[model samples]
Target: MKHQTSQLEFSRPLQVDRVPRLGSVEKLSAEPKELKALAKRMKLPALHALSAELRATPWRGGGLKVEGHLTADIEQVSVISLEAFRETVSLPVSRYFLPAGAVNDNDQEDDADPISNGWVDLGEVVAEILALDLDPYPRKPGEAFEEHVEIEAEPKPESPFAVLARRKGD
Candidate 1:
């Protein structure tokens, strides 16, 4: 599909309290300019494509659970080669958000965050996940780090006088 470039920011706000009990599924794709903005925000060389399929389910009577898969096409400079190369990132998304001040069951909620102003910004969530998954030290496939090691110099031969002195002492 053709995407017209625009100056609009990337944003998708979902009201946590309005989530249906049966759950809702949504698919999101970033526009060219949105992608560019996100790339700059994340300090990436380039972001060619960004998309996600998310499902939001009401949970614990007041909390929301969001599950999805994220896919992105990005460019990064390889640490080994110092050249820009393309990479495709496909990762699962799972996040739970509880209403601010709401009680959450202790277990299985380690990843939970508090909903702000009754809403969750899905676009920012997508961008944050993408940023978290980027490789800190990118490298091309089949490339291995080879460290430069210096060779040790040979030790000088012991003096003949030293050996003679040792023999005399013996």
Candidate 2:
């Protein structure tokens, strides 16, 4: 269902049937138009570049394992400065794909899923990784965050339960 509702503007599906006995390697690079669409979908200020080198090998019971490394140049708005800044990110990628109805003993591998239409979208994998790796509150170096919130100097009143307990103790 995730693939059906996919808003991923960038996609490069690795065909399951094409993988050989040893393994297969693929290098994916995003085009300019794809980068623009992906940035919009991912809610980023800009995604300048995205590329990955992936290796696909056979796994347990007709499943497939894809491992790769991706590099991206991105622009984000700093949470403190609120100004756009650019950063280069490098990340290691790993994912498992099971054929539909195949059994998986490793329950902890919840991210594993069946291939969509006999293929795995490598671009989606990279995009998801980038999304997770992006800093939620990005700040440029030396841009310190100052807490504008002021704490109450006066002590708070005791709760009713605490007061009652104190009275009982007395």
- Superposition TM-score, candidate 1 onto the true structure: 0.79
Please provide TM-scores, in order, for all candidate models, with all chains considered together: 0.79, 0.80
Candidate No. with top lDDT: 2
How much is 59 displaced in model 1, in angstroms? 1.1
Instruction: For residues 1-170, write the lDDT of model 2, one tens digit per residue.
Output: 23343666888877776789798998999999999998887789999999999998977757789898999999989888789999899999998888876635666655687877677888888888888988888888678867788877898888999999999999
Q: Candidate 1: where is the Cα deviation over 4 Å?
A: 1-9, 103-109, 151-170
Which prediction has the highest TM-score against the true structure? 2
The alpha-carbon RMSD values of the candidates against the true structure, listed in the order shown, are 6.5, 5.7
Q: After best superposition, candidate 1 residue 57: deviation in angstroms?
A: 0.2
Query: Candidate 2: where are CA atoms >4 Å away?
Result: 1-7, 103-106, 109-111, 155-170
Task: Give, for candidate 1, the lowest lDDT window spanning 10 residues.
Answer: 1-10
Candidates' C-alpha lDDT = 0.83, 0.84
